[model samples]
Target: MQNALKELILQMADDALVLGHRNSEWTGIGPMLEEDLAFSSMAQDKIGHALALYTILHEHMGEPDPDKLGFMRKEEEYRCCQFVELPIGEYDFTLARHFLYDHAELIRYEMLVNCPFEPLAQMARKVRGELKYHVLHADTFLRELARGTEESKARMQAAIRYAWPYALGMFEITDADAQLAAAGAYAGEKERRSRWLSTVSSIINDAGLQVPEPDEAKAIYGGRKGYHSEYLKPLLDEMTEVVRLDPTAEW
Candidate 1:
């Protein structure tokens, strides 16, 4: 039970760390100044969340320090979903991905709020509050973009189609998932995915967009098992560059 709980926490931490890095890449590159600030703020929130989770692991669960676990791992050691490893392609794709991913994250944390694990449940309560604003930001942008001119709408729709499969990958089930669920440490990916679909569908419908059919959506998996896309290796290399240069040096 403890091992399963640790696995769940590590996956969540990895997801936040990677996606936060991706989002931070937009710091000065967002299409609009407001979006730039918003994404940057969210990026900070995500990385902070990752650090908090890692601290829990280190302080209570006997895991290594957060820096070592986050920066010293080999690419294959990461358990983040393929959805977060991909580069932020464009504003439209980034927006769509953010919208889909955060909704799923929100639901996951909401379930975690009542977890049997006391530390995790406490963390979940805080995380769920932060995610409310994230979903609000994503929803506001999605609605505005979807209702804009033809070009903006087309771009959003295309991004939605392209990201939907990878977004589904965020919910890839693992053997440990059952253990976690049975232990009441988590609600499991299946329930989260179901709620995600319903929530995202409603938002998409309100934005005058069509939700991709689940049967037809091919989820890209394997990240939880240590497999990743071609992009992750390079991203990890970049992420660890400074840390690798001087592992003994204090930040």
Candidate 2:
């Protein structure tokens, strides 16, 4: 009913779409068999969530196809955080991304579950139910990796370092976040971000890992503004090419 809601919905839709594609990159390349399955399944869930969100956006926008919105959007038009577009690092890195994202989704969706908008709140509740399992799966793996062999520990630490800045990208404090909260589409971002950082920092400390200082003034930016890394375009081209091949073709 409002442009604010439209933009807010699209931001979530696009974030899930791109992040799902990024997660999908590890379909067969994970360090272990268990990890391969875990990452692949996580990617599936992210993509599934993206589909649901995009379907909502499509209906609201009077669009016909969800695939077009996910696949056909130009790079600069995408609203996915830069964190999702970065190349997949080792299994450790993969876990880092998963651990941060799943927990953040849990918090974000928990807030959204009570949104003023009934349809969006319903979707948030549905996705939050699924994210419960996703977060656990990631959390278990992160703990094991932290307590595993020396090599595993080193790699996990390195992954955490690599993933730290990107993790911050998850909190895109833009007009969209404000608008959504103002419209009752979501709880405010400020509170959510603080809770997320504290939650994540505790996990890091428990893992015997070090978390560097947090200076919001020094944080990296761009995903919210649509400037992504080199990884996004190629990923999207492969992801969307088949759909774009014949836009009228029915599944």
Best by lDDT: 1
Q: Write the per-residue lDDT of candidate 1 for residues 1-251, one digit (tens) a residue.
A: 88888888989999999999999999888998999999999999999999999999999899999998988988888999999998999999999999999999999999998888889899999999999999999999999999999999999999999998899899999888999878778879999999999999999998999988875248999899899999899998999889788899987
Clashing pairs in 1: none
Name the lDDT value of residue 205 in candidate 1. Answer: 94
What TM-score would you give candidate 1 relative to the actual structure?
0.98
Off by over 4 Å in 1: none
Give the local distance difference test score of model 1. 0.92
Q: Model 2, range 168-219, lDDT digits (tens) per residue? A: 7777677766777666677665777788889888888888877756667645
Native-structure RMSD, model 2? 1.8
TM-score of each: 0.98, 0.92
